[model samples]
Target: MTKKGDQRQAEELDPRKQTILKAVVDDYVETAEPVGSESLLQRYPLGVKPATVRNEMATISDMGYLHQPHTSAGRAPTHRGYRYYVDRLAEPMNEDEARQIARRLAKTVESQPEMVTATLRMLSGITRYAAVATTARDQSLKLLKCVVTPLTRGRALMMCAFDNGSVDSHVVDLGSALSAQQMRRLNASIAKLVEGQQAAEVVALKLSLPVVEDRFLQDAIARTLRAAQSSARVATRGELYYEGILKMMEHVEFQRSLESLEQVLGALQDKHRVYDAMEQTPENELSVMVGEENPVPELQNCSMVVARYKAGKREGGVIGVVGPARMRYSETLPLVQQMARSLSGVLAKLIEE
Candidate 1:
């Protein structure tokens, strides 16, 4: 069925059934156990007797929203049930929590790598799930500046700064030291050759100079050019940051089966697959995929809350939280939204400044 048809069918569920499903999902998320009518009556204000609630639960199960794991066990939500519950969640983020998220994000170091690391740490710490983000490589990123610093007797470090607020560095072995005048002349030569070139162009670009009599200057220029090419290649590829994998393993879902855990870990290890999954969500919007809704086979048993954040006016990237299908959607949604907002704001400011 189409998404609209699926939504309409979910909406057609009676009000009482919706309430019971919400309660069961909430309780299951909290305790990771099957919920029965007796437990619902004690914890939630369901205005019905035991017989009525049990009958309703049975009917909902028949419709495939809830599943009975064992013949004697109570009902837990199926993937369909989680989908319905997530679609209907209406809770808004708390004002205090929003302020806290903003405050923490503002304190992140104003560099690309540091900002990504701090954002991942805060996300995993708040959600207690694995947090992953990928920064898209901009082919048109211009090489704004390049600095070459002489290190030991035979080594030098070359740092290249890009227009997108990212810096790539390389260390090269220089055959001989360059004099002050030669260094100045070499810097000028490099700036003229490659400073305004795009990262994609620089990857295949060759740095050349008019004939210079000094062999030391010739060798130094050659080494720096090769290092610049390496740095350009680094700049042209996307960057992936992932954290909290070990922490995610502490959840009971993964502990249930060694094979399941291995499968999930293996899937996440593939950067291309993870990037493809994130690509399904549109830019500047938050998306939730629960259980079977996930496209990746290993992730089908899991849930993901993903959001795309703007890095600059024309640049964007994806950030996400991954956990078991029984994740607390009500809380995860707002947290992911806030993190995306903060990340976009910080990145925009960094790019501008």
Candidate 2:
């Protein structure tokens, strides 16, 4: 079946089915227990007989939206059911609800760097699911200022400052010593060559510079530029917080899926994976992945919600959340989006300062 067909089939539940589905999902989400028709009818007014509800639950289970943990136990919504409910049945966040989330996010973070931590905490606290926030490997770097500092007779230090107020230093060996005045001149010249350029661009610019016949300064400048460029290309990752891990363990599905999640989290430490994921993201949009939709196997059983946020007009990063596939999309989507927006606002202000 086509993707839409799968979604539609899941959501094609009738009113009674929807009512029961919602009840099961809600009760399970709250109590982490299998929900029986009688318990559901008693807990929430469904305006239907228990036998009818039972029959409908049977159909829902047959449709792959609900599952029976045992032969006689009540039904619980499966991942398919959760996906269907999220896509069609769950109530969209209203303006008041969105505003409340915005207010809550605003109160937690005072600076840009703090936003990642605040966002993870907020998501975990609000959703009672494990929340994760990661800054893309590529997002943490930018050109600020590049300067060549002489370390000794034949060694020099290439220092580059990023707009994020981070300074990176790399050592370069010179072929020969030069006077302080000559070194100063070379520093100014190299700064002019690549002060504001991106790390990759700086490397290209260095390679294309006209070859000078003067061997000493030529070698020094070449080595200095190479060091500076290498420093710029270095990826620095911001903190990734995994909140409500205990809550995640509370869910049977999550416990079963923890091995996959651990693999994904372990792979996240590989800068390339995080960078590839970030690069694959379309600009100025929020990306959602629901079970099997994620490219990584470790995330196949989880839903990933990611959004890119700018620190200023030109600088930015990404924030994301990872949780069980049965996550509350209605609530998590808006929460993740709002956190990204709020983080961007705070980051922009910090950049201005």
Candidate 3:
């Protein structure tokens, strides 16, 4: 149904109806079993008797918030029911849980990549679902050093070093011979231009041929700098890291989504596709996209609980858990949020050191 229709229906529900709907969603999430009126009255302290509870469950099912799989079976939450619970009924996860998540992430890792891997590993273990981490699209590419070597007449090799410990080199055809002193000067000037700036910022930079007296020297430096900037931007494809695919497979819903599982795994392995999934929802806010609500067809049977984390300084990235739609939202939602914040802190600390 449309957003307007969903809202209108929500508004029409009285307090009693809303309370029953919340109870049904919460119970179904916990047990992954259908909730009958008898179960509701038995579990909750609602003063209503069994008949009234049954009537309300029937009404909610009729209103598209709940579904009954069989004639004698109990009713379970539909996608709309889950949506309503997330938007209105779900309570914030507590302070103690948040503290535990933070402490777990504070442990040291060897490098930025390891920190990312560890983040997903910890999150998957905590949530019992497939956890994924996508690095920030933009990272400040800090230049560390530049070297120019004479390969042959009218040609030289330029090697640029970045703070990330990766080196890139390309050959520049000077169109004329260059001296060792001139090569040193070219390297120094290039470093001075981009040492502290971001990759994007320096890529658009215009260099001066008049910076040096010799035309061959100036031309060589310009070509080399362009090569370095291009290389940096090309390396900006964010890395995709995932864990606990098997853990999630332990659930029944994913098992039923068997044919779609291969497609989902393929998408996970492709960072661009993972980034697309991350961008499907807005940044910073935690979201629960259930069943048909998922943008990807392969994930239509699955539910994704995603949140964003800071990559370090200016830009941020995304992380989250993907599990069956029957996932316990009350348990999973806050954990994902806390883990994202912890990941941001870890990456920031890594950047500082």
Candidate 4:
């Protein structure tokens, strides 16, 4: 989600202060160490006296941009500081990099799942952080086929297969015996009626049909609708895939123990939870939830950078990376957006195919 501007409205930063903020974030991201005014002066030609830089650092710290980790250690950018850097100061991804990413994806990806995996892998590899993609979107489910198979003398199973390659089946008690001819007619009727219909449309079942002479097949068709709806309800819970969890472990933030890493992964393992985080951010806008800004305590020490990617023309999915609060937002943010564009193209092509 885009950062809300009201938080920064209390006191508009001067141009010099913005430069200090950007320098501090850039240096910290590079070194993963606290940044001091002296280092800023040495690395950047700020044209400000050392004392003035120190004073401004204190002012920005008071404004919640920078924080001193220890009395002896230099100050570092707070979550608010990262927010300001992303919204106002981060550099755009140059065309050369974007074109390179396009060429790379075009050569390697050949299928929908491959494209999704490649995008998450690219994000994880480049950001050097845990990356996640929610691959199963419920809205993308469309009826591919519906069939009824006899289970016993008076019972059968109604099965519905969707475009996403998911199958859902429900047992139907026939009550009366269904002959082979009767079952064939019922399956043909259902296949014809649900040919291009969505799950909801299948459930509604507004189909023009000849009067069914077979009572058992009539009951079976009614039960098939229930089975499709059940599948639709089950699909609301999407599947989650994660990569580069070990990359996250290398960061100092997670080096103390494996507990933090475990907690973060456990929290993210739930597809619905991660999907909510992605959707909770502004639609079609890249969002950066830094450190304590994250709603879940497990992610309070980390950051979640996410955006939605279109799945063909009608459906969409979530993609994101998780790393320490001190992240290369300037580098990773644009890369994630780039990977999403490539993945969207792959999905659109699959839809066409």
Candidate 5:
């Protein structure tokens, strides 16, 4: 039988390999270039010969963790390499540092739009990579209140307030005029039924309510509820900051990668498509999809990092960043996590207010 110690060791990289891998990844991240054994030794005190490091790099390359560009003199980590580094080699943020980062993000961006824009800017600025922050689709919206006001003999305006403090208004046309008392009764009934339910649930409940004496009023209410339900469908907004676009032109792989990125951005612009992609991802998990692992072929040359942010008990959204496979995971991971947490906190407070 395999010993427990053996199993544990099998799950982890050998110390020498781990150190070399870390050194290589760190060097590539800083320089944004392929790393060689000579440079690795110069940057790290590994007490090893250049030839020995070169052999280890070859082993890593054979394992599909490193790739050599035709034009470059050395090797760069592949997406698989980045995955292993993130899952095992990277250090976790300390409690105090995490809190400080969270606080800084919270103080910097005060609104939803600001939060998204700031996140995209920061991701691009720090990583010198293209960045994206897409809003989550399929968020559940709760009704906080509803108000109905008669605008004409055969028309009325309905205003709905979501628990997230976003208000939607619609105008409904009735077949004929109704008395003020009849309007009051209809308003009271709708407010009571919709104040604590989702748009779909409200529509279902309204349909089951006892039909009033005036069929016209009942029809108007149904139409209004349907309009509200349609309006509540998931909507996505985002900011895509393409940093170092010119810098990418310096690499051959980027020639094809840039074209793919444009198509991906176009897909993101269609809110429904963005929602569909975000919903396919699981909640409360940091998802990383690289190269061909992406469902969208246009993303084949890119890597995406996604996480969800909740606004208190009701509203929520998703935040994500996109970059090349060789992007820096150690820095980007913490930054994204911190941004999501701070965004949730700010949105929760805004909705509460």
Candidate 6:
């Protein structure tokens, strides 16, 4: 049978077998222990004899959905079992719950990067899983304004505001203070060099030092330009923000095998790998990749629930939750789906203002 046909077969399981499989999965997810027929019957209304339940479980295990870790032990859901179970879940976030969560995230963050960081932190906090997100600022967005604010201790702050509602700023050590007249001149010259230019253009621009020859002002301008260019490259590639790695470690799956945890964390630490994984979910869609479905070798033993959000007509970003295959799909799935929609709404409003 084709893959879809196989999934259909799993879905079309007899009602009794389906009930047994669901009970095993739910019990294993909660207790992290293989579930025997007696244990399942005690907790769930299987409405079948002990012998019948054990026979059905054995049949289910033969179908490759459940596996006996030891010869005489109870069964647990395999990766395929998780896939089948997650595919059948249709839970949606409650309307009031969505409103409360969206209201909490409605407070505007200062910039695109700040918004991504804030979203990821909230996602991790809620799900107790590692969360990751990408920032989706376009590389071709023009620089709208450049502001230089003088600070004490031979320092000044330079902020570059882009047309797409993103801001990049850096603080520089001027090595000397600039008079108001000199600061004004520096601002004008800097603006002329970069205002209305695309981020990539500014990054690649060959600077012709401005007319005023104050050495300190010139050096500060050079530092600011370099910082802006660096920021542009990071923004263009969709800079990644992640949180809650420590929280994820509390799970039984990770606590049992530190090496396995390290391997997954190592893969996540690679920006390219994370971006590639996040890109698998198309724009405005939700994806649930269970263990072994993930392309990254290190992540093959992990599960990911991802959704993409659009900030503009074409530019988009991804947010995701990563955890073990036994993750609470009933809870995590709706949370991820709702958070992604809420984030997109917040970004849309931010761009409007």
How do these models rank on lDDT, best leading? 1, 6, 4, 3, 2, 5
> Per-residue lDDT tens digits of candidate 2, residues 1-353?
01211234444777777878888887886666789988998899899898998899898898889999988887777767777766666665677877877777667546655676777777777777666555544543557788777788788877888877778888778778877977886787688777877665665776665466667887788777777776765634444555665665665665566675566556555554555454445667777766666666555666677777776786466666667676767677777777777777766676787
Two-way TM-score contest, 2 vs 6, winner? 6
Would you list the clashing residue pairs of candidate 1?
none
TM-score, model 2 to reference: 0.60
lDDT of 3 by residue, 234-331 (tens): 55547777889878667765566666666666655666555667755566678667766776666766778888888677456678888877777778
Higher-ranked by TM-score: 1 or 2: 1
Pairs in clash, predicted candidate 5 = none
TM-score of each: 0.70, 0.60, 0.68, 0.71, 0.60, 0.69
* Candidate 6 lDDT over residue span 1-353, tens digit each: 00111232454568788778788888998999999999898999988899999899888888889999998889999988888778764357789988987898888555667877788889899888899887664677788888778899778888888777878788867668888987887788778888888887887865665645678878877766676676565545667788897776888988999999999889888887777677667766788888887767798788889888778455668887988888888788888888888888888877888
Off by over 4 Å in 5: 1-12, 94-97, 108-115, 122-124, 134-274
True lDDT of residue 88, candidate 4: 82
Off by over 4 Å in 1: 1-11, 139-237
Per-residue alpha-carbon lDDT of candidate 5 for residues 135-161, written as tens digits (9 for 90 to 100): 544335677787878888788887887
Q: Is candidate 2 or candidate 6 better by lDDT?
A: 6
Tens-digit lDDT string for candidate 4 (182-286): 778867877877755776566566354445766667777666655556665554446677888778778876776689878877777665566656656555777
On lDDT, the leading prediction is: 1
Native-referenced Cα lDDT, model 5: 0.66
Which runs of model 6 end up more than 4 angstroms from their true locations? 1-11, 137-236, 312-314
Model 5 root mean square deviation, Cα atoms = 11.1
Q: How close is candidate 1 to the true structure, as a TM-score?
A: 0.70
- Evaluated at residue 291, the lDDT of candidate 5 is 55
Question: At residue 318, what lDDT does model 2 achieve?
Answer: 64
Backbone Cα, N, C clashes tallied per candidate: 0, 0, 0, 1, 0, 0
